[model samples]
Target: MANVIVAGASRGIGLELARQHVEAGDRVFALVRDPDNAGELPGLASSSGGKLTVHAADVTSDSSVADAAKSVDADGIDYVYIVAGIVGKMEPMLEPGDWDTFDEAIEIMLKGPLRVLRAFLPKLSEGSKVIAFSSQLAASTWPYGGFYPYVAAKNGLNRMFRSVAIDLKDRGIVVGTIHPGYVQTDMGGPDADITPQESASEIRKLAEWWPLDKTGDFYKWNGEPHAW
Candidate 1:
């Protein structure tokens, strides 16, 4: 079984990813911001049939990420999925704009994954897969507004992973981004079309069969290619 690290595994899609991996008998290291206050991650780890370990990590913090990475075994990880992000306020921008809100979104959605990658890249084996969460809003063709920061940040994440895929290609490491669909989570809201379980399951399946040929592309939860 593969050694999988699910960063931002405290709740929502990330939690489901960790659950699925552990249930499938893979060794799963779940990284969350607060180990003490995390909703169910602690309980899940206790009863994960000995396949799960919970690590306290906030992707926004480099030291926390490094500590979490140090907890992983030296055999090298088979998969690393970064799923932390925020949509920020849905309000339209003012004349001068809300730079603070925009910066927060960019930090979490873009820089957070980059920090985790920097800390864990050394633990990734040649055939390893690194997947980061992006959104369809990141598409340049998608004419939208109000969520500018979120969209721009996800787009940046996509480009970063794409470049990483190229840089790590010769070593057999596959780096890619995925749009988990309009999943029904707190972030996705009540009107979202799909459930977190469905999205997580599809993601797991896709990662299992993800070919080296499609290393740098973005994909929908159903395994369909998504245009950048």
Candidate 2:
């Protein structure tokens, strides 16, 4: 069994990823913003026979990420999944007046994962896999002006992870990005094409079949490569 760390495990795809990892006999370290607020994860972890541990962390906070990183005591993490992000109400990007709304979106969607990767890199072993979430918006241009910040942030994440993969390749750490499609999560809404469980399962399959040489490639949940 491998040692895995999943960020944003409180709900949606992250939660399902954690559940599937535990079921696969992997030791899972689930990081969430609030332990007290984690609804079903705590119980799920407990039922997994001590295979899972939840750590409280706000990805936007450096100290919180550092503390959460220290909680994983294994020799090194085998996989690190960055699944935390936010989607604001669909509106024109300029409608928000470019202050708190844009700032929040950038922090949670872009800077947050960068902070987590920086803090946790040292804890990952050689041959480890780092999978981060990107979005379809990163590839396709949207005619709507709204969600500009979200689109830009995910594009930034994809670029950052690509660079990370290049830098870490010789060390045996495979860094890559994935788009989970339009899943029926809180963020994805009810009209989304897929379910969280289906998305998580596809991710697991990708993880298992991931080629070391394809470290920097971006992928879809259905196992197809995505355009940058």
Candidate 3:
């Protein structure tokens, strides 16, 4: 079975991805900000028949990510999914914005993916696939406006991964971004379009089959090419 790492797998879609990989009998390293408070990840690992390991990792902290990456006792990682994010303030630009949350969004969604990638590079083998979460709002074609922090962070994340895909193309390391739909979860809220299970299921398929030729492209959870 393939070795998979699901970063920010404390709950929601991240937790669902961890569960899916564990059930598939793949070795899964599930990372969270607090292992002690990682909700179902601990129990899932306990019952995963040695297929899952939980580690405490704060994407905002370099040392924490490095330490967590060191805990993955594997010869190579086949997949690395960076799924940590914060909704932050759903507001338009004001004279004085919520700078703390805005800063947090950039750190977690933009810089965070890069940090996780750097720490896990040693474990990633050729042909390994890395997918990070991006939002439809990040697309330039999307005309709607609002949620400045979330939109900006996702935009930055998409470009960063795109550059990475270009950098790692010769090595056959596929890198791309996915918009996990408007999934119904704590972050997506109740009025979202789909459930977490559905979103994760489709995303799993993409992670498995998304090609090197299509690397650097952003896609929807349903496997459709998303607008840049």
Q: lDDT of each prediction vs. the true structure? A: 0.89, 0.88, 0.92
Model 3, span 1-228: residue lDDT tens: 999999989899999999998888899999999999989889999999889999989999999999999988998999999999988877577776448988999999999999999999888767899999998989998898788899999999999899999999988899999999998989889899999899999999999999999999999999999988
lDDT of 1 by residue, 108-140 (tens): 889999898889988886789999999999987
> Could you estimate the TM-score for every candidate?
0.96, 0.95, 0.97
Better of 1 and 2 by lDDT: 1
TM-score of 2: 0.95
Which structure among the candidates has the greatest TM-score? Answer: 3
Q: lDDT score, residue 170, model 1? A: 92
What clash pairs does model 2 have?
Answer: none
lDDT by residue (tens digit), candidate 2, 32-75: 99999988899998899999999998988999999999888887
How do all the candidates rank in terms of TM-score, highest first?
3, 1, 2
CA displacement after TM-score superposition, residue 183 of candidate 2 (Å): 0.6
Candidate 1 worst ten-residue window by lDDT: 89-98
Candidate 3, position 42, lDDT: 94
Candidate 1: C-alpha RMSD to true structure equals 1.2
